[model samples]
Target: MIHMAVTPKDRSHIRTYKTAKQAWERLEKLFLGNESIQSSRFEEVNNAANNFVMLEGETAEEVHRRLTALALQLTELGATFADDAWIKRKFFTALLPYEEMKSGARESRELIRLLWPTETLPTDLANLIKWLETAPDRFIDWKESAARAGADMALSFVLSWYDEVNLDQLECRRADVEENLPAENKTARLARACAIADFVDKRVFIEDPNPPSDDEEELEDEEIEMESPPPAVDPAGPPPAGA
Candidate 1:
C-alpha cells in the first residue's frame, strides 16, 4: 500500500526501507499524512496547504473558521504544523492575490510588523483576528481619501469633455486626492467589502451587521383554496335542512 501511495519520484527513497511501516514513515516525511489515512487524504492536505489564501471578500472570522477547518483536516490526515506559531504565520500571509489587494497586503504586512516587531508574523492568530475586526478607526481618514479618489474616478467616466487641458487638470486633482488615500481606491474597497457590508468590511474585516443566519430555514408556503361560500344562501329564504 505504501509503495502504491508514494509518488513515483519518492519510490527510490522508500524502496530501500524494507518494511511497509518504514516506507509509510518516509512517505509521511515527504508530505503530510499517516499510515492510517487513505492515500487520497494525504494528497488532499498537501494540495490544501499549497492553495490556502484569503478569498477576496472573506471576513476575519471567516478566515479563522477556514483555518480551523483546515487544521482539523490536517489532524484527521495525520499531519500538523511544526508549531502554533507556524499556523499563525500562515494566517498572516494569506492575503488575496489581486492588483488592488497588493497595496493592502503590504500595509497589512507592515501592521503585522508593528504588532510583532519580528521577522515573522509572531502574534497569536486570535489576537490578530481581533485587531483586524476592531481596527476601523485606523482606516477612517484613509477611507475618506479613497472616497475622494473614487469620486474622481466616477466623474471621469461620464466626462463629455476630455480635452487635453481638462484631462491634465483632472489628473492633477486626482493625484492630489489620492495623496492621502490608502493603498487601494474606493471601488477596490467596495469590491473587497461586497454589497451589504460595503466599505465597512473593507475598512474592517468583521461580520456583517445583519449577517444571514444559517439556522433560519426558509419555509415553503402552502397554497390554500377557499371553499365557495355555501351556495350563496338567499338573504330572506333560509335553506330547508331542518330549519
Candidate 2:
C-alpha cells in the first residue's frame, strides 16, 4: 500500500527501503529535515493571521477559502491557539470595516435562525462570517438603486418647478437663499430647485452643465488695451494748446 501510494518519481528514491517504516523515515528525512521548515511555516501562519485583508472585489467565499487554506496549513504545522473563538476573533479583526460587518452579519444570522427554526445551520460565527462576505454586493446594489431613484425624483421636482415658473431661458441659479427666511417665494423656490438639480446632476450623473473655463486670452487682451497709455495722445497733431 505504501509503495502504491508513492508516486513513480518518488518511488525510485525509496526503492532501497524494504519496509513501510523505513520508507516513511527516508521520506521524512528528505522532506522535513531540521527546524527550517517549521520556522518558515510558523512565519507563514503568523503572517496569514496578522495581515489578512478583504480585497475590494473579492467575495466572502474566496476570502474564506484563502483563510481556511492558511488555517489548515497552520494546523498541519502544529500551531495551536486558545480556541476556535480566539482564531475567529483574530481573523475578523484583521478584516477591514470589521465592526460594522460583524454586527450586520450577527443580525442577519439571527434573522435566519428565527426564520428556520429546525434547520441544521452551521455555527453562528461561521454563518455570520459567510453573511459578511456576501452582504456587501447586495448592499452596494441597493444603495446604487436608491441613489438613482432619488436623482430621478429630484430631477422631476426641478422640471415641474421650471415649468410652473416659466423660466425657460433662465440659466442655473445659485443656491444662496437665506436659511432664516420665514416663507419661500417663487425666486427662492426656483433657486432651491436649481440647486437640487445641480447637486443631483453632479453627484449622481457626474455631469457638470457649467464647468468653469479659463478666459486667460480675453483677460490678457483687456489688460494690454488698458495698459497701452492711449497712444501718447498724438501730441504733434493735437490743437488743444489754448482751449
Candidate 3:
C-alpha cells in the first residue's frame, strides 16, 4: 500500500522501511522534517537573510520580497523578534552595499528614506513593500489627498481590504458613499473615510471596480466540488498528500 501510495520518486525512501509506522515516519521526515532538521533548515535561511546584499540592478521591491519571504520562512521554523524596529533594521542591512564609510552611509540613508511615507517609515512588512513598490512619492500624494479630505486622514492609511466589505450590495453602497463624499467630507471624514478604505483597498481596479459579472456569478453559483480524497493506506492510516 505504501509503495502504491507514494510517487515513484518518494517510493525509494519508503521501500527500505519494513513497517507502516517506519514508512510513515520516513515520509514525515522527508516532507515535514523533525525539530533538529527544521532547525538546520532555519539556520540555512537565517544565513541567507543575514548575508543578503543587493544585486547591482535589483529593485527594492524585488529584494524586499525575497528577504521578507526568507524571514517569514525562518519565523515559521521558530519564534524570533518580529518587532517593527527589528524587521526594519534587518531589511535595511540587506538593502545597502557599502563601498566607503561616508558615501555608503549617506547613500544608505537616502535609500532608506525612499521607503518612508511623509514623516515616518512604514511600521509593518506589507506597508513597507507597498510603500516601496508604489514609490514613496505616490504615498505622499495619497496622504496629502486624504489630509485635504479630513483631519484624521492618517487613520485612512490603517490598511483595510475590500474583501472585508465585499458583498455585492455593500460594494455599490461604498461606491455611492465615495461619489457623495465631497458633501459629507466637509464636516468630518466619516463617510469619506469609509469610502476611501474600500477605494484604496483595491490593489487593482482601474477599469470598472464593479462586482463579479453575470457569467462570473453563475460560475460561482454552480461551482464544481473538489475531487474526493484518495483512500488511506490503511483505514487507520492518514490520507495521502494529494488529499
Candidate 4:
C-alpha cells in the first residue's frame, strides 16, 4: 500500500530502506525537513508585515488584502496570534503614517462609519473590501476632505502620522449629540452597535491585500531563484586551475 501511495520517483527511496519502519522514518525526515523550510518561508512573509505601508495611490482595501495574505500565510504555518482583534490591530498599525483613527470605537467600526455611514457594515473582511470598492463617491468625498484639511500644518501632521480624520473636535461634538438623544433613541443605538459587532465577529481577519496573478507569481518565482545563493559544489570533485 505504501509503495502504491508514493510517486514513481519516490519508490526508489522506499526500496533503498530494508524495512518498512526504515522507509517510514526516512520519508518522515524528508517531509519534516521540507516543513521546516516552509516554516522559515512563513517567517519571511511575517517579516514583510513590518515593511507594509499604504502606498500613495493604494486604497485601504488593497492594503488590507496584501496584509491579509501575509496573515493567512502565518496561520497556515501553524503560527497563531492572540485573536482576530490582534490581527485587525496589526493590519491597522501596518498602515503606517496613517495613525489610528481618533474614534474611540474599534478600528473596523470606525472605518465602516468613515466609508459608509448609512449602510450596515459587513462583519467579514472580504465584504468590507467589497464595500469600499463599490463606493467611489464616498471615497471622493473622503479624499477631498483629507486634501482640504491637509492644508493646515497641525492637521496635516496629524493626518499623515496618525492617519486620522481632521474632524476639529468631532469626538466632543459626538458626545454632545449623544447627550441630547432621547432615551429610546439611545437604546436603539446601543442595540445597533451590538448587532454590528455580532454580525462582524467583533472583527474579521484580513486576507490577501493583493493576491498575485499567475504571471506575477512566475515573475516573483524567477526573482526569488535569481536572488537565492548557488548550491555548494563537492570539495573532492573538480578544481579549476589558475587561468
Candidate 5:
C-alpha cells in the first residue's frame, strides 16, 4: 500500500456535484474565491482548482483527455517561464513542421520579416556579428544577473546556431553569444540592441546639420535641394560592447 501526502486545503476542496455543469460552477466559484489568496503554496491551489475543473466536465474518459492536454500546455508554459530559450526555440520549433509543406518556410519567413523587419536575417545577423566583436563576456561578468534576468540557455544556444550557420564564422563573438540565444531571447536582446543603436546612430554618430552657407541661401532661392550626409561611425565605433 502507498500513502500520499495531502494538504488540508486540498482535502477541504474535494467536492462532488450531481451534474457536470454544477461541478463546473463550483470549480469556477472556488477558483474565483481564492484568486487573491497568494502564497508560496500556489502549486497546491492550482492543482486543486484544475482537478475540480476536470471533474466538472464531460465523461470521465473525456475529462482525462482534456486534463492531459491542459497539463501539456501548462508544462510548456512552465518551461518557457523558466528559460528564455524554451520560448524562443518553441517558436522556431512551431515553424519547423511546416518547413516542408509547400513553401511553408518561405511564408513563415516572409511573415516574420514583416512583423520584425529589423531583427530578420542577413541584416540582423550582420549587425549581431558587429556587436559581438566588442561586447563584454556576459558569462563571466553576469552569470548571476543572467540567471536572475531569466535569460535562457536555450535562447543563447539558438542564437549561436544562427551565428554559426549564417556567418560561417568559427570563433564566438559578443554578437555570437547573442545569436546563440534562442529566437525569443534573441528578439528581446536585439530589440534592446536596436534601440541603443538607433540612439547612438541618431545622437552620437549622425553629423550635425551644416550651418546654411551664404551660397545655400542663394541655392534655396534657386530651388536647389541639398541632401544631408549619412550618420558617422564613432572613431572607436559602436558601443563598448555587451554579452
Candidate 6:
C-alpha cells in the first residue's frame, strides 16, 4: 500500500470570502472534519456580514476587518492583527478587485461627470481616473516589472480613489442607514435617500416664477388705461368732425 501526504489546513484559506456568508460556507467546509464549532452561530456571523456588505454598502475588507477585530476583541480566536497578512491575502485581495471594478462603475454618474467635467476636474481626481483607466498597461515598459504588478496597479487605482474620496466613510454612512432599518424594512433605503437628496437639490434652484402670467399682465395694462386721464377730446374733436 502506498501512503500519500496530506496538506494541512492553514489560516490563509479560511479568510477568502467576499461576504461573511461566503466565508461561513468555506469555514463550514474546512471544519467539517474537525470537532470544534459547537453551534450555528459561526454560520450566523457570516450571514450577518453578508447582509452588512450587500445592504449597508460595507466593503468586504471592512467586514473582514470587523470580524477579525471582533474575534480578537472577544478572544474568540487566537488570531491577532499581527497575523493579518493572511487576511489581506485571502479577503482584501479578492474583495478589492471587485471593489475597484465597482469604484470604476460608480464614476459613471452622468450628472456628477457633467457638473464636474473631467476637462476641468481637479488635477488630483483627474489624474487618478486617468491612471485608473489606463492601468498597468501604460507602465508596461517600466524596467523589471513583476508579473503581479498589474494587479498592484489595479489596487492602486482603486485605493487612490478610496483614499482621496474617502469611500469607506461614505460606506460607513450607508451602513448607518441600513442599521436603522429592520432587515425586512431596509429595502432601498440607500436609493431612497439618494433620490430625496437629488430632488431637494433640484428644488433649490429658483426659476423665474413662470414669467408672471400673461392674464395678470393684461389686467394690469387695462388698469393703467383706466387710470390715465382722458384725452382733451371734447371741443377739438367736435370741431374736426364738423369740418
Candidate 4 residue runs with Cα over 4 Å from true position:
1-35, 99-243
Measured with C-alpha atoms, the lDDT of residue 193 in candidate 1 is 42
Ten residues in a row with the worst lDDT in model 5? 199-208
| Model 3, span 1-243: residue lDDT tens | 888988885676677679999998867755687778887887887887767776766777887777666665665555376445656776778654533433644554455474342347545546555645656565555565544444233334442434354334532444565666675465576665666555452222122234579999677756643345555667668777999
Model 5 reaches what TM-score against the true structure? 0.14
Per-model CA lDDT versus the true structure: 0.58, 0.63, 0.60, 0.64, 0.44, 0.48
Q: Which wins on lDDT, candidate 2 or candidate 3?
A: 2
What lDDT tens digits, residue by residue, belong to model 1 across residues 51-128?
788886787678767876677556545565624675677677674354346566567767755433434652554655
Question: Cα lDDT for residue 49, model 2?
Answer: 68
Q: Report the lDDT of model 6 for residue 75.
A: 25
Better candidate number, 1 or 5, judged by lDDT: 1
lDDT of 1 at 72: 56
Model 6 pairs in collision = none
Instruction: Write the number of the candidate with greater lDDT, choosing between 2 and 5.
Output: 2
Q: Model 5: residues >4 Å from true position, as ranges?
A: 1-81, 104-243
Off by over 4 Å in 6: 1-37, 46-65, 70-83, 90-98, 106-243
Query: TM-scores of all models?
Result: 0.27, 0.31, 0.28, 0.27, 0.14, 0.22
Q: Residue 193 in model 6: shift from native, Å?
A: 53
Residue pairs with colliding backbones in model 1 are none
- Indicate which candidate wins on TM-score: 2
Deviation (Å) of 196 in candidate 6: 50
For candidate 3, the 10 contiguous residues with the lowest summed lDDT are: 201-210
Clashes of each: 0, 0, 0, 11, 17, 0
RMSD of 3: 27.5
